[model samples]
Target chain A: MDKSLQKTEQEEIESKRKVYREAKEQTRKNARRLRFDESNPQPKKDSVDSPRKRFYRQRAHSNPFSDHRLDYPKSPESMDWSKYYPQYHDKESNNMLQDVEIADIGCGYGGLLINLSKEFPKTLCLGMEIRVQVTQYVEDRIIALREQNKSKDINYQNIAVIRGNAMKFLPNFFKKSQLSKMFFCFPDPHFKQRKHKARIITNTLLSEYAYALKVGGIIYTITDVEDLHNWMVEHLTEHPLFERLDKQWEDQDKCVEIMYNSTEEGQKVERNKGDKFIACFRRLPDPEI
Target chain B: MKHPYQNIVSTSTHLFVSVQNHLQAFDVEGNLVGSWKDTIGHEDLLKKQQLEKIEKLNQEPEIKRAENNKKVKIPKIPTPGPGAPTIYNYIRDLELTHDNKYLIGITDSDKSIIIFEINLNEDNCLKLIKRQTFPKRPCSISIADDNSTVIIGDKFGDVYKIPIIGENVPEKDLKPILGHVSLLTDVLITEHNGKQYILSSDRDEHIKVSNYPITYVVKHWLFGHDEFISSMVQFDFDRELLVTGGGDDYIYLWNWYGNKLLSKYPLRDLIEPLLDESHLPPERFLHEDSPKEISVVKMITMDKFVVVLFQKVNGLLVLEIKDETLHLVELFPLDYPLIDISAGGDKIFGLSEDKIITQFTFNGKLTIDDKEFKGMIENNPCEVQSKEEFYPLYTMNTLRKRSEH
Candidate 1:
């Protein structure tokens, strides 16, 4: 088993090395072309073409304007993590009950993740996104934040990003009573009238959230769409193992301040008084009956 | 043979002595062409704007009496519009689209800008057509002439040429144009003597001017600060001269082509009064007790004057350098820090620290026709500037490097 694990690690290393080489070479060519343009002004064309060739690799790889997408050519199958766990700095540091260790679901593009991490530096933060492109995006975001942390002592080891479906892989990864806080700031509303149930925050999903969170663990929901907000409230409020916090709790809740100021979504909502209704629910102990 | 601003001038300003024939062609939008620029009394700008609005609403003129304090909600206004820019904050850095058109903004929810074309169009129209998204956070963005390629500069020194093709697809290799190790604050495709150049500035005290293979380091060891270089701008009239504002509380004017040294404009005067009687941060401030945190310098204009809107004071200061002298002019003050400023034609637009735009003229008469803006006391009668940190416990060093680079 050890040997196989080593072999798998080596394969991962090789794959990343190849990707780095491609990125480096691409960087060099791009630098050259950019420099060329600086010296000689060139008229822009209609397309921001992607130069995808591995040094003249071909027309097949080229994206005329660079935004072309297609399915992965099989065996380029993306990696999946299940029954996976990371080495935490310490064990006594389980942040579930005492502090908020949040998992921002569907952290698209990443603005929300960045803001939340900064606002609640003490809160253990994790971002989950299913889109492979945006997952890599969160990776870069973590890297940049880590870079900016150099001059200040703001430690964000508490923060991380993982690629997986929160719905599919929650049980395989985190055991029950793990996360203290869960945020569904903004999800793909799937406003398609028929696909209304396809939305991320659902009653079944609330159960999943209940499973992952410890007793007293809180779930925070916010959305600009009134329909989605009502839907979220309806689902979570009806869940048996949950109870609502009071206005004082809402006001004194650090998470409330975090919610109010942290995300670009927060800023937009605040600006328009845009019905960005927020609701917080706490997980209750399972019924003895 | 020698000029004081030669040190920071990337392209010197062709200085303007007085106002010229102002074009009355357009006022921001082409349709709102009321009174473009017929050198009327200073009040004409806002007054004419109001009269035009009255005409648009077809409201009967009010009797000759006192103006009402009750204001109408001008939807196309100083209020939130459909084009109200959605700024993305990735903790430390900021990214705004070329315009709040399609996908107005994108950030990693942290400090990274991923490339996404929003229809971030700041237009009056509600329809949006966001064509594509890139996985890079470009700190600065500008479009090429054909509008096909948008040049995006990231804080990590990656410059990308994003193709604005109509469709978003997967097969394309999106990453292009990469260099530098620091965040780029602003970028401009400059034209000088029929030559083209890309001038980029960062938190570093240098403004890089390049034409690809040939790159000119306009201001290398700008000796002013020990902190980040926040921004740089050319005096509109000067093509070879430019000014840079940094955390060091000093604005620099450099000579672009000649790479000559220039004088420094210390910003101590503007905030010195505010910093009076202050509790000190670990860093140094002009006044003994003043908190020495790195105050950010926002926008600089070419007329040898920089308008700095800092956190402590959200007001505008006119930093002018004329005849080899530097002066700070206080145009007006805002309730909060000024984040961004944009000027087109003679009208000026400023965004406050609160993310709202206060649209008005930087230069206006004491009264708008009848309502007089009684000149504020340089030293207000009853109020005393506080000596405490405006934002207690909030460290400006949060913008500085923290650790894991």
Candidate 2:
């Protein structure tokens, strides 16, 4: 029995080392593929491939309060969206064809952006993720999809991903009432009593969301945690600028159906047979005092 | 032991200073008129009283032995270290109502807003009228122009509006009108063309100007600073010109109403010689050999000049505004570091690190005044026993964001 136990321990350590070696090899290959230099200025349309998710796995949670070093425009006017959407750039005018009207906050794995691209083909949709590796994965995934569908009519030119802390300075990247739809799908649920302030949805963050959304703009939220869902519902219902949409409104909305099944977290919940709760709120006109 | 006055406010008839947990008011002649102390040690006193009662009832000796045995079996949990969160019961922010009828202060111990009715004739000038507690500690306070509402910004990035004189509403009934996800540094309520607006700055280098009362309606954001804003003051001569300084290397002058950047006055050339080793970044970044940083501690405007103080620096920078531009006029050096400053009438009173008040007058040139309030107002004794018991004398640098996960 003692000999068998020793042999099993040795095997476990060997297996762990093998996993680490595989991850390191995958990282090297990914770096080589993403390198852009004078020799390889642009890749052939069919050569681009989707990045593997196993090579880009990161921790599920990130603290919203910490000052993560991020690159963001000083204001909406200073933001040059042409680089993010090169196909839509107008060379004569030195500007993009349209502004980003849809935002997916904490868009993990590019699942929802992929689904939303087809639903709102004309609208420019952007995903904002805080984690470094996760954001790069989404960018690679979008690039691969766009290259793969170059011959199709509905090319994936309208979707883009950026690394940003939306909680701190959403106004810095977008003008007043610039977004028509904002998604908060499966955000980090800071569960500690003292950490409730770090939760993505709160009374204060709602005001910023309201500022970015035009009148009648919709904010869609879904989560697997019932407690977080209740907290989001309570705060959104209390904010004067946001009015909760009823069940009938949720039933008729096509985006709600897409949101329920698109994200990676939602699929994980579906596999585990867990409950999913969704709430939608509409931005109201400012009151005259 | 010397205790620096953390806060000093001057009114027309009296001067008030907060030392540790004590708030003392003095008349123009430097006579201590009235005083108030925070209820800091009441919990310890109650625990002592309860233990004495238990000791008296346990004279049987059998119960005592059993208790001793249980104590021996269970080890006591160690006390938290310096980095742990501790409840400090001292005045964090103080402001006077527009009418000057009441003095408002927020206590850090209980997170309560205390209102005092100022009566000079009575022996006890400060009458504790109302004490209302909130969910978070209030970091900055501002009274509305109409004097009916009190706007408080807390460390949790929420701005709440409470009535100066109104019914005692429960804590649950109170709600914040606006908020930021980052920590709030300063909040101000200013008027343009008879319309009130709220200007709030956060640690994320954002200064939002929103419509007052209807605070849900955001007007615009002033977005030039790459560092957290530590202080913001409106130009006395031109309300449209907003002056802001913070953890950055420069101060910005803005035409807030028009959303234009008028000027950016760099401070590194002026303050680099004054930076010492103590001005280095917090311990986490020591390995990087990063350069020292400067944070603007306090700023006040007088006539056409703005008096600015940097954290732990033993000097003051006076800037003259010309053509909507900020030009450094003079740097008045001091013997000791300055803690806080207040402007009263034509005189500027500075509280230094040595626990004394230095007066300065600005006619055509800045000169020190001969008047002294050392023996009278600075003689009050505090109960601090050791260096660890004293509260922090400077906290503006803590507003700088750290690169941590």
Candidate 3:
């Protein structure tokens, strides 16, 4: 065979191998997209059978004005959290010895809790989302992850998600000084002047948060909205039981990285290239009068 | 048999009388001095009256000729069901300050309690000073002894201490001092050994006693009522003695501080006679085990007399307490069930379920005082026609003052 003929055949073989590799990468991308959120049923792309585009829209829910009914356990002691995180409890013993030490208020999509669970495997974490469907989705995601990693050493057994209005029932789930960390990632802004009270961070709510957290417990808050971020920082700074930690301290925290990268809202903000304001505060020890 | 008086509370010079939809003021002579109908109820009443007038006009031959003119219609208003908030909210309870200068009353409506400044010093000027509205409907209210703070217990079992002169207090500032686990039925601010405490009873049969002002520390739970604890009163003579009546057929007297049940007075036998078949709706009894649901609707306690009104019963039991023993001294029967009763100035006035106001005179005999009210006879008897002219402090003349109507 001539040299030119041999080189032409080799080039054809190389092009075919490149096509095969590109096809394999496309298949992997499809698999990852399929597993993004099974709870949110998405139809196949480029199909006329699916009428609704953007199936799971990301519109923030407004503040509940009237007839806001959220079920709450009678007391912190009365709540059977084992149902939310069954693996935490010993099946044979049927006893729950561990309590959730980290809580995410308004845990929309539960990105923070999932990420924090990896950083603090021994500490139990809970995400409380008021919206029923969002809570169910987060719960389903956790369940799926738990089942997927059943054989692996890394299982999501220490995290759980619950449907609850954290503002009204924070004390109902957490005993005094039970929580070490509380996360507030991208909460509803409630922008209107009349709706300022509906904001999650208030003087009264700060007292409640202080009661639930330990003396040195840290409150991790991040928001793309500057007004809400400022409102939270002002409230936490003004609160007698809390002292705002500077940006230097926040940069050193491991939870900050997971909080910025892990939450669904955080990822959305990253994709949009929005400015995120992060603030962390440590609950101060009670003053000896 | 005439205008029904459900609850009659008296000030120094006048009585704060509550009928079905109106809280009227009257002298001891039982004349309507001034009255304020619930604004909500007033709207309903006006609509009903207008409809009746239209109905009469429709029957007339002139209406047929002018049918085209009457084409413009009035929108139908929805009727309020049981426990529904209506325009004319019922006056659940009322209280007068120590000086009898301010009269505060809580209605059955959500988020509002009306306050009236009674200037009987100048004239029989009963002016609605303010409407203290909040996010939550107050189930029970107790005026502090100093008249500076009003303690309100909401249906959510949260107790809030509202300043009487809170002109511009924000809603967030009024956080709950203490909370119960269930719906609160009644709350009272009682003082013992110079320290004030809040005694609150709930539908869950739990009477929580908490330290007032600083109410986070729960003192005790006086828990004995089998069902919803509806009415509670602290003995005027003895601060420790508490009398509570509820869904149960008996009234329990408890030593609150000691957390001890002193006595349980059974009213089942006495209440049965008052429970005439006519009083109860025929449909209600068709269901199984309805008779046992008979509860004490109201309990009015005085120094020596205790008046107990049974649910679905027309008459009230007047028991005389002599040496810590209760004897059924009087059982005043009525054609209509008594809705509320209040005792003041040595007289008991019972408001029936309907528009009948019966006065059981000092000796337990029913007497009808003159229906007409003698006008306000004060040192400076000035008749103010409009609420705007009377309450100059408030610019908005809300249709709250019943006397204006």
Candidate 4:
């Protein structure tokens, strides 16, 4: 073949390669959206022990967004899966053992969700917001994370924020001993006498906390409200299933980190140097009747 | 009954929505679970109100400092009652007449605007009396140019008028003034070039100046920026020139009477020096995406600096309209959505959508001579509308000279 012809063929090959590469990138982008977050997930197992081991098994796969391998809206009687599922699992990342499952009872702006998801990839954290605007925010953040390949490593899959009420739905998602920890940080401290009945704390509620936890599970709470802390202590103590975690143990508590790094409200509470109070309680063994 | 969070997975626990107050979460077996107290039904605002009571008492001659110091702080009780009404899911968008008594404020719940009669006793405190409710969630309200009638326009583009000082007149008493289809975002009672007109701006992008269906004059429709039309004002100092801003980024200025398009006032881009000392802060400011979803979120004016809310920027703002352009002044402390802001005489009152009414000077002062306000916030207890009354035990500032509607 002549030299000119050979050069023309070389140019054609280069252009074809460029087209192939663009097509491949397009395919990958499409796949990212279709593939739910399946990254680094541990199969449901009998080992309720070994938080670290559980972390690895859960983090064994890769996908930016994952739905715990369960279908969205696991049941249709309540929230529509279509609206709730699209943004469940966020950017897949390396799993880490420190990750623990968290439920942000009134997650206002996914600020808490983002913080917890990164802090404990081993933990599956959820932000529950009632306001559609804020709830949709968390849903988007999870998607952005997955699309960015933010969650690719570590020992566990970290987060799944839902738009629902922890007060109304706690029973729906969690069972006795399911959550190793519970965080009621910066809850409303209803102050009026008639409204006192509205405070999230009461002798009865403390019992609910006791019932939700495992024999050894712990409840961590914080507030800028000094009076509310007193209310929490009173209720937590009166309940039969709980005991105040010793102050010594309180300082060493790992859950404090999540509370400190929570969403907009938490940050606001922190900035005002508002009177902040922290409380911790453990689920004591149910005694003989 | 309202939860701003999701319902967790099913367990035996359930709290009936009807048992709204003082409800604790209980498993299906009737075992008490979580405290509904902490969630929707929590009374944090009440506690904050009581703290205000103590603060107010701290000002009294009777509650000696030593005596108050010695009294053990009751964690739950803030005060027995002399405080701002602790309202939940209510409406707010305030328009106070110059004297401050004839306040046209709206309650967001039932979407009603009320004209309240005001009286300030010896102390410069505030009192609201003779409340007449209208059938509209008012975005802007103004007393008729003659001061004979109160005109209020709702989000749904209905403007109703009631006699300012008169017998309780329901819907029949109302005269349909400015009727349109979409939201009528603003209404101004202005006299331009010697003729009086009701200048109304609506979602339809038209600002109509007229006496209504009888005969109408359409102002030049401000046709440029596109977004939900929010607030429109005839600059207090210069009622002829109009300044209007809304969901759109730009604030447009129009000749209030000539119907001439003047200029556009835009929020500082945070990068401009015009933002001055009031430059948007880096942290804690409400991010852009938060407030736009809900329209009619801010209420502003021109004479004083135009106060912008944080729903768009997550901060309290001041837009100083100069040469028809906006100069972003220093942002203030008020957060979330500012429901209503009114200025007249020597004071400015900012009422939050959450029922927080903050009064301050053009400069800044923590305390005001609210001593004049007798029966409104400082003295209100359990009140009866037609014939009911609630008398609580501990009373201090609760004793007002009292007035009857």
Q: How large is the interface RMSD of each prediction? A: 25.3, 1.8, 11.3, 29.7
Better candidate number, 2 or 3, judged by DockQ: 2
- Put down candidate 2 lDDT per residue, B1-405, tens digits, no spaces: 566678877775677788777888877567888889887543543454466456655654677868667432332234569898765567887788867778888887767788888898899799888887777878888888888878889888889988877666787687888889878899999889989989999888899998898887788899899889988898666799899999999989999888899999999988989989889987877767687899998898888888998999978899999998999898888877888887776777788656467777876457888877755445566745566766788887778777754
Instruction: Tell me the interface RMSD of model 4, in angstroms.
Output: 29.7
Q: Pick the candidate with the highest DockQ.
A: 2
Q: Report the Cα RMSD per candidate.
A: 26.8, 6.2, 16.3, 26.6
- Give the Cα-based TM-score of candidate 1 against the true structure: 0.36
Report the lDDT of model 1 for residue B337: 51
Report the lDDT of model 2 for residue B367: 87
- Cα miss at A90, model 1 (Å)? 58
Let me know the TM-score candidate 4 reaches against the reference structure: 0.36
TM-score of chain A of each: 0.63, 0.86, 0.78, 0.63
lDDT for each residue of candidate 2 in A1-289, tens digit (9 for 90 to 100): 6999999997887676557546544643443454322255555433366767766777998888777878888788899887787777787898888899999999999899989999988889999999887887887787778767878867888999899999986899989899999999999988887798888888877888888999999999999999999999999998899999999999999999999999999999999999999999999998875
Task: Please give, for residues A118-234, the per-residue lDDT of candidate 1 as tens digits.
Answer: 676666677776655455545544544543453565644356667655543443345457688887776656666545434666553455567678789888877788888888787
Which 10-residue span in candidate 2 chain A carries the lowest summed lDDT?
Answer: A29-38
Which whole-number lDDT from 0 to 100 does residue A81 have in model 1?
Answer: 20
Q: lDDT, candidate 2, residue B137?
A: 78
lDDT of the candidates, in the order given:
0.47, 0.82, 0.68, 0.49
Per-residue lDDT tens digits for candidate 3, residues A135-154, read 65566567556656656666
Instruction: Count clashing residue pairs per candidate.
Output: 78, 0, 16, 86
* lDDT for each residue of candidate 1 in B7-29, tens digit (9 for 90 to 100): 00011110100011111111222
Q: Candidate 2 DockQ score?
A: 0.55
Calculate DockQ per candidate and list them: 0.02, 0.55, 0.03, 0.01
Better of 1 and 4 by lDDT: 4
